[model samples]
Target: MRPARGSPDTRSGVRWGMRLTLNIDASPLRRWHLLLIERLETISGLDLSISLPETDLPDQSGLGPLFRVEGLLHNLRSDGLFARASRAEVTVATDRPMDESDLVLDLGDGRASVPGRRWTLHVDGDAGEGALVAALLAGRMPLVELKEGGALIAAGRPGTEYGRILLATLDDVLSRVVTLIVSAVSGGRLRVPTLPPTEAEQAAAVPQAGIAQTVVKAGFSKAIELVYRSCFHAPHWRVGWRRLDGPDLFALKRHPDSGWTDLPDDGTRFYADPFPILHEGKLTLFVEDFVHATGKGIISAVEFGPDGPLGAPEPVFEQPGHLSYPFVFARDGEVWMIPESCSAGRVDLFRATAFPGGWVKEATLIEGVTASDATLVERDGLWWLFATVRDGGGSFSDALHLWSAPDFRGPWTAHPRNPVLIDIASARPAGQMVIRDGELLRPVQDCRQGYGKALGIARVTRLDGEGFAQEVETIIEAGGPLWPGRRLHSLNSAGGFEFIDGSAMVRRNPLARRKPAAVLASS
Candidate 1:
């Protein structure tokens, strides 16, 4: 029995709901804080109010110059940029006085211990300090928590954008906090997070870059990106495949020593998000065929023989807007596909009238969501759909949301505790789920280095109506003797064939005069 929203414990006088006071620093609030307040107001049973700390918070206006310099260099817009809490635009419910029974949410740097039921934000075990900024400067996405005293209410590993580190990370952090509150109010139990432990050696512990240093770094990064784009199609991806004779990537936790055979691509386009399946007793591979000329992705398929692919992938499905991820499976004796169409603002179901062609839209699984890589699995007589949602303008690769339905197609219900996880390293679904040794294993994208920078096989500890939890057992990076690509994006296997995808540098103009390996590799 989940609570729809947060109320005091049953023993409290107000049984149905309780008053909520958001305690913040006395300094002027920033745009994000105001945005957060507005969001909370939309939820029922929150009975929201605000209280300011007695003491003024330290001024953080000094970061203004650095932000401006970095913004100009990267052409960063103000949409999601972070400034300071030193300025105010609007005021929220500061008129009301807090009652003894009111639940206090401490969102201040002072970390005042409040009476009664209280919630506080902590970053890397530091309560309400400049921990967020410290983690960002150290080039890490720190573990964040919403705690009541020493008890962990909810925790998340927020992702950051190196280009717009401050703004993006702030958005992600706030999104996680909001998720925690929503879960508590909705009668969902906020349990201790089961996220994988991080090694201390992985922490960079780098000092914050100064304004000049930030500007220089941004400029240098932009210069290299420009050169790379000029010379090749940026973010070009290629599919890799090898027959699965032994344990697959999930079991091995590393690429096979024999390595993967590259699926050749013409210079005009690239392939990614490989999904291989066996239909009609024949092996077929589907991919996101991204054409450089049109700058859009279409679902393409190719039949594979015992040795390798029979030929190049042919366009099997196309939509009004860009489509990819082509999640295909056999249901009710008919082959169906749900390709990623987040640009079209919907997750669609397609039926292949013909084996590999003649596709028709059967249904719309979900709509009005910017969700990526819709993965479906049946467990305990329920169909569960997993995808990372881009909520209120944040990174697309974080904030994992879940939906469950009795049937795979229609009438899906959003999970009450949505975004059950928010770790950049293991939130986004890389491919379909697999069961091994009576344990359910999921392939998740590790975006800590960057989007699709690596792949992780996570063991799902708990997944149900209450909440979700997973422990990442292995993180596989793309390099060394087997897979030499810079990014290991997705993983899938079927019909004794294992498939993966990764970043590849392709010449923008195939006919251009050949350049030395050193010159080409420098970009």
Candidate 2:
């Protein structure tokens, strides 16, 4: 049916809806610039066009020669590099004249006069080239901002590993740009959160580590890892437990003064992702039992007696793919679990027919998404699911997404604004969310140093149909008197006992170097 005279038509929005022009420098462009243009074209009610304005960018501190040699070496040795998406190549584009538009996305260095509204992009307050690279060389990702006539409209801190600085950081920054533009076109309120630390305060500029230095560092790191693996079952994790007689982590916002007791584990396998739940007046602790031999993980549970865990965690649920982060909770007189199964590309819900065992697949809450650590909570008569998604191509620990449902099981709907939070320090769920003094406190993974290097407790100030926001109040790291490890991964509490997990080193006996008799295959 044709629309009325004045009604908006999404099919023909190019004629009636807003027109957006992306202004770029006359010099060569990067792969991510084209990626941003491709994404804008997919929106329904907006028309996108390219503009090449005569401009020049600041020098990139001699990065052109450095990246050429670094990228080639990285491509040749595939195993040691950080998880990355694309190689940012400076390629040429055909010149095109600017079309009349309602909005201009100025990606150039200068803030020239434009036809309509102009939002200029800035990195760490510098609207010049090499800003991102300069920040990375100084040892951190840059804070990206969008400004209109020097007024801040939106800002975000883009994160990535230092090895693939150019490609990974660009991927995340462009991802945020899409979110900003889409919200504007859809009449949604723009999120103008407080800007993070300034570039000067964050770090001082340092020269890029030359190719020789990087090669030496990589070789030394690789050799140490090989030796560690040969001498021990490396990357082994262990859980810690203590009676919760005083304030919990949410209220305390720090590790308890009294040290935690270690949860015993056999040498064959290690346990992590501690989740303690109470059902029908019984307390049980569940973990991700990862067998070193099989190289797979399964959900396991153990009953807690008056003193401590009755025994080691026994396999309660097994799948064909790896699983972790067993987020078990009680609802509607039943116990349910949603484990991290991103390898399967879906989030599945399971109900416990028998208290801690006999878990059966109940429903698939979400599909076709590689979401990590799916955490579900009920608030204001609605169930909200939080997880970090690998949107487009970037780190899985940076882009957070949300879904809402009437119940915990079916008919889950994605939030209108996804990638609601794009911060590597506090995007991934570390454990369950808790309530303290009429406020919501969530445990999050701080992956700034490395994956699961520390834990952060954030206060959720705003969470509704409109959007989500949080303030990280505390960061708890490992290697203290209580917890001695390199990575503090997860935290949870129930039935008067609190639980946490971190990396532990377990040596393998050199005399018994042979493989185990039977490998526990996943079902």
Candidate 3:
């Protein structure tokens, strides 16, 4: 439907959607630019048009007549500037010498000359194609296949690892861009939210001489580690636990490094994502069991007593696709589970027909999404679901999204400010959302260094139908006597027992190499 043509409504406080004319520099237009236009077409309440200049370098002085049109103007090229005295409202500005590899986008309320939001993107692919591919995929924006160097590459099909990384980088920027644009159009404040700091920013913030030496040392150390792993060592993860009481829940002190017990695992498999649940006065510990042979994970459980695990963990649930992060909870006297099913391309909810076994798929809360570590909580007479979603193809540890429903079952509505938070240091769900002293606190995975390097405790400052916000209160790292690892990912509690998981080092079995037939047959 066409938007009504008028000024913003002062009485109703609803800004009338205006016709947008894109004054783009068509000379360097690429596949990504075309994809952006396709996305813009899908947005309602905006009539869009495009105007291209005949000359390579269009005269900026002559753009005044073009700006005098009936609606708002989007000057996508920085060279074209409106006269200071002009009365038209221009909302966008692109920096000069724009290339596919680097772009600076500035956004502002149409009424202002100074832009309040700015994003600088350094494309990481060949000639900026990687960044463009990322933007197209992350937004789910479509584009026709384009030929390059005798090969046809589709918009969504990023064929290389570098391409995928580029896509993730672009996706991150695009997610923030959409947020800022939607907020501005809705007459909200033009303040930009915090996002993951760029690599350059992180480097510049550190001492250059020290950083250089550290980088060189780290590179050499990593090379040696890689060699050692290839010859004798293998990476492993193990679960750890400590008993807790009511008072311990509030002022929980870290157990001594020697006091924590390690969950047993076969040399061939590793255990992670520990979730403890108390059911009918019995405590059961659930975890993700990943086997090296299949390179996929399955859900496993072990009975936990006052001392420790009663026996070894047994398979509780297995799917054709990989599953991990067994987020289990009790509601209405029934047990429900929502494991990490990103590999299956959905957020599936399963109910136990009989205790831990006979688990059946009850419903799919979300489909066609790559979501991780879904956590749920009921508050304010509403049930809110939180998870970190991968937009197209990017880092799965950033971009937190929320959905709410009157009940845990059907008709879940997405939060208006979707992707409410996007920061690598604190966006991914790490564990169960808990209420401390009547205030809600969320456990987030801090992936700034790498996946699950630490845990962050964030307090939800504001949450409603209109918007969402949070403040990270504490960061828990993985370097103590009890739990010593390079990565600490999951945290959960039940039945006065708190569980966590972290990376561990394991030696490869020398006999495995000697018995090649046995290894192959077992696999």
Candidate 4:
């Protein structure tokens, strides 16, 4: 053991060079390392210089050698350059003489071998994906490991650029192969990581009177951010009252083809929700018009016109009861909608008697349950509705429930496996799903840390089975005042533009030059 020395005075990497044999205390941890390596390699475009031990170490349970690796990341801000003799390379030489004089990484794809001692790396996802191990081997890759608190385990020297990124803590080599293997073998199913259980820490009270809202640089671009003003008693939402006060216009972010600047203020305030549909010849938006009052509800309508919201919102229809989450779906020329009839304890539908407005109730799909934010998608001749129901608290609580109807208008059935997906953070629907290169991508509000605070993306790998198989990635977080006070996340699509509701936009994009609805006309 060459005394660990990568301090300011003397910079030396933890010298463990020899045919090294490493073991993950738990199998899942091994799998996790392999996955991160592959992903980071793909995303950062750097070939990793780390690898797991060649042989498997059964999960005997206990925080293995990884614990030490974790501690190093938290404590060391800079890994300092290596020995002046070799500043560019972080070499790992084995004590035992090896038959092959090469650096070999076993990613199970095969072993990625290079006729060299060390390799340079950056976090990337373009290392090419097949199986994590196989891809690594195919690419002759090493891994960057993830330890406690998602810290990286780097065993070599660090350059200035690498050091700055290490601010997010990229210390270890990644193993992208093993984790993907587990995912494939399990049919792409996802669950809370099966790591060793952790103790619950007492949550610090939501900070004192005025905790200055600080900026948090995120590794991913966030979709939503929220700021809890502790000035009033119990906050506004909890008291069931949200005021529609603003500049009274929604300055659009990710505005559409209409060349619109903002939504109208003629008493129409857009809520952070989006509905996507193929109406006539192009994709269209049916955004939320939320009325903030004692008996407030969301309006179901689309923004029309060539430029943008042509005018104040045109009247769509009035549900006798509260209505929100009015999602529009068009199939074979006829338009249909699934509005939040949660208060009525069911998901009901209506056919549009006219385009842009005028919808008549057609059928009641699911009955005898509570559901809000109901979004509908038709795949393989099956109508699937993604929605949230009451599991505990009355507000947006519990996992999202999936129900299917043979026809958009009929008695629907819930997926045999109810709560098809859980995790408040990624399970709740932020808006509508986007079809990118044939992939069904849903923008999810990650409430795991808190409600509507962080944003995640769930790519549905499988929805044919009893339940869905998804791959989730936390993609964004609220930065700070540069936008608004946080809480900006939702996926919206209208015409040719895919609108991402960010914190700064006050009103929906409603211009008439290109779109059908006039922003301030016919109010």
Candidate 5:
């Protein structure tokens, strides 16, 4: 008993559906697509169940299902770029999917190839559903398989205009299928993704926007819950200089509009944490040089007068593991430096027995605590330290913690503001504090981009015997009209400010624009 030709069947459908039968041999990049599927459900408000083929992926290796879904999910959920879907459904065509809910698209020709997928995607019910299905089976037109979330509506109902939205929903699904099919390759692939980075985020990630600025946009894509994530293996640290770089010294000269100029050196990144004190007469700088390519970082000393890059980055402390965020200072005629030992579970103090490099471990300030970007301050005869600690499941670089002691040694007390600050945009310790007028001003890092990509200022609003409150004053972002390309914001000091600029590509020179990112190679 089929319905009359002109009679519309009204039905509001909501179901958890869809499946993925991946035909790939490796999982490093494949498993990621699984996560992409789950995200589609969240964004679309559909209870979607996305699955992969029944092959055994490595449990510990990159192939395993992990939290890859989580880290990306937040970015999507936190931002609302689309309206909720009222009614929509998806059916996938794949090989050996573990679940029964997944199957071939109802309109596609029963084959499993790219061309068939494309044709199925472009099909419209009015033109000829049969032709669409036949084209899908023949593999002439493509069947676009996508994991997506989108705005949709229940159609052909008795009295609802919002009843059924066919064209829009179909268009969105078609786009997703195209994007999903082509996301796996390199070169000339016109991808119609279910979701892509909103234009705003793309602007932020693009280079040379300016100094001290940032924007975060959530991407749209389906994702899966695999309880898997990538763990970064701490890399080794190396110290060296680019022979092609210009001199490091500056003449207090400022850029006409851009602000300042210093020769570019691609070695390690540092802020003005101060290592070798120039207080005795000569100028010395202590900084943590983080080597980007190797993922390792270290601490070193540099001496400079009017010229530049005093000497071949004098060796001070080198290690197989990380030794950075060095907060160097002079105490009672001894030079002490506190490098980021958060990895070693303690903050060790090294007293420089000799002038620039020679030093010995004099004490341990804190133990069993995770800290990084450690910077210290002394006022009213009390020593206070600042660093960012790892929050239960967030980036350690985003949370700031504080500890104080009568001296820089044991028995330190957690500041009443244990998490002296919680805003990731400006919490982690940056460069050393500089004396401003009469007040002490500290430079803080604003990691709006998952790393130190912006410089933030914190003014001491209250202090003395009563304690203190840090008031965030302002932020300087990368790629201002003057300074561009993810640059300007550094870790600590600038010269009078000094910070290892992360926004700028290594191959760039102040006089030169940072190289543009290579064009996308899609298939």
Candidate 6:
């Protein structure tokens, strides 16, 4: 079939300094085409010409060799037996020889051409509405190749979340295509790195069917518990501390048998996110005091002695929206805080105008991001900010993004690879990072079962402009008699004391028992 006429040149500011052609089937112009075109347009120096099967032919015989894309639009209409057979045909066609410079991106579901020569990819969906959604979500595409004998070559497991999986797969496909085209034109082999499986995929191998079944069977019990708790029990958090002699924060486990001394509360409110700081040879613990009536949290602090807290936690800072995760640190001879204010859609900085009582807004480090637990660290002459931001829609504890700046106050630039880490096991920052023996150790929330079900330690392997990486070293669960709860989330330390908080059950007050009626009393 004669190729159709070329579309208007949308090429603006070419990136790769080469001309390329994409010959896609005219009948199946799809959403994937638009995505591919949009991404390619971002690259400068490369002049792109999208040619359909009905477009007029150009005299390419004299151009030595041309970079081309083909065989991405078949099986769009066929289905059942015919569709399967057509897929097989498309796979076979991918192995055909072309100009060494010609790059073929085969996304069909069949045998793939040899790797290192031709690029092939596969998206796990049928060619219809499902396929369209998959194409749209694909931010990076995964590479797939079939050997001469139909052996598949790929890394990592498939993701459970369809949106994340599709986006990553599509992103990989486009990235690989760009690498191939750029290398072919520049006479340099730019190899695309092997991508790890998405967080959903890495976590999918664990079976949750039995757990889900149990939850369903216990629905009545859970409903009754919920009703009772709502009517009587309010969430109350207390701070537990262990004396640290020489920065062996992990030694807090040794006193597992010692019971926790509850930080006093008025029963109308609860306290959490305990962060202790030492100033002028005195220890002051900061917490998120959440009032049940107001349904909002405010920053509060209390003095701690060698035995326990000196008095009640007094309010230090309060904002219009809900505030939690009072991540405080001492820098430049002043106290600073970066609390989680996701409700306000910004992460703001607060400086103590008066120690432990008065705090004023210093600056808004990051705006327009629904960030939680904005932890800051000064490393290698740069300030690094770690937070889990909710982008679009998903769990807030799964994706970790990083930003670095020369100064803490202004001009923060996001890491080149934002959302650098995406594992529910250790993505959310539970508390401030501690440096031990010149090594950075971060406290992460293990949300595999639920938010803050447990606490984990991740040792930083790499953190720079290129990327961010970490390995979970230790996991601390809520157990061992001292702290009895199903959730253990925050961890912090100051002076000779380390603080932790967790969940606890609250029962109905016995003092509020009803009195006998007036007639019975008189009798």
How do the predictions measure up, each by TM-score? 0.89, 0.83, 0.68, 0.47, 0.48, 0.62
Judge candidate 4 at residue 137 and give its lDDT.
19
lDDT of 1 by residue, 291-399 (tens): 8889999989999999989988999888778989989999899999989988777788889999788889988988899998999999888999999887766678777
Model 2 global lDDT (CA atoms, 0 to 1): 0.71
What is the C-alpha local distance difference test score of each model? 0.74, 0.71, 0.58, 0.42, 0.42, 0.56
lDDT of 3 by residue, 1-523 (tens): 4335465543222335544443343223322333344545555554444333344433322322322321122212222212121112222333222232111232211121222222222222222233333333232221212222234221111111121122233444444334333333333332212334433224333322332343344445556766766753344677877776444322443333344567876567788999888998999988999877688899999999998899978998999999999999999999999999897788989998887767998899988788989999999899999997776644676667889989887578887656665556667888898888888888777665556766667778777877677776666667656566666777788887887788876556645434321111000
Q: Which residue segments of model 4 deviate by more than 4 Å?
A: 1-190, 193-270, 276-278, 281-284, 293-295, 300-302, 392-395, 479-482, 502-523
lDDT per residue, candidate 2, 1-523, as tens digits?
Answer: 5444445654433334456777766233544566566666666656566665344334334444444444454443321212222323222233433446677778777555677678787777877545655665555655667778878766655565433434344445455555555444444334433433322223334565754564455556556767878977867888889998898887787788997887877667888999999888889999999988799999999999878999878999999999999999988889999999998899999999987888999999999999999999889889999999875566678778899999888699998767677776788899999887889889988776557877888889989877889988878878756677667888899999999988877777533335422211110
Of the candidates numbered 1 and 4, which has the greater TM-score value? 1
lDDT of 5 by residue, 112-183 (tens): 332222212223222223332232222122222222112111111000011011122222223233222322
Please list all clashing residue pairs in model 3, or write none if there are none. 134-167, 257-481, 257-482
lDDT score, residue 227, model 3? 75
Q: lDDT tens digits, residues 1-523, model 4?
A: 3432222111111122222112221122232343333333332112234433344444332222222333343453332211011212323222323223232333322233333342222222222222222322122212222221232222111111121122221221121123322222222323431111111101211221111111112111121222121211111110001112221012222212232233333322334355656677744456555553234555644444554443454447676676666677777678877777777887788888877677887788877777867777777788788886653222353356788878777557776555554344456677667666678877676543334544566678878645575666335544332223334355555454444443322223234224532222101
Sort by TM-score, top down from the best: 1, 2, 3, 6, 5, 4
Best by TM-score: 1
- Candidate 2 has which clashing residue pairs, if any? none
- The weakest ten consecutive residues by lDDT in model 2 span 78-87
Instruction: Give the winner by lDDT: 2 or 4.
Output: 2
Write the residue-wise lDDT of candidate 6 on 324-428 in tens digits: 999888889998888899978888988998998688898999988888899999998999999986654445666577999998886899875556655555778
So what's the TM-score on candidate 1? 0.89
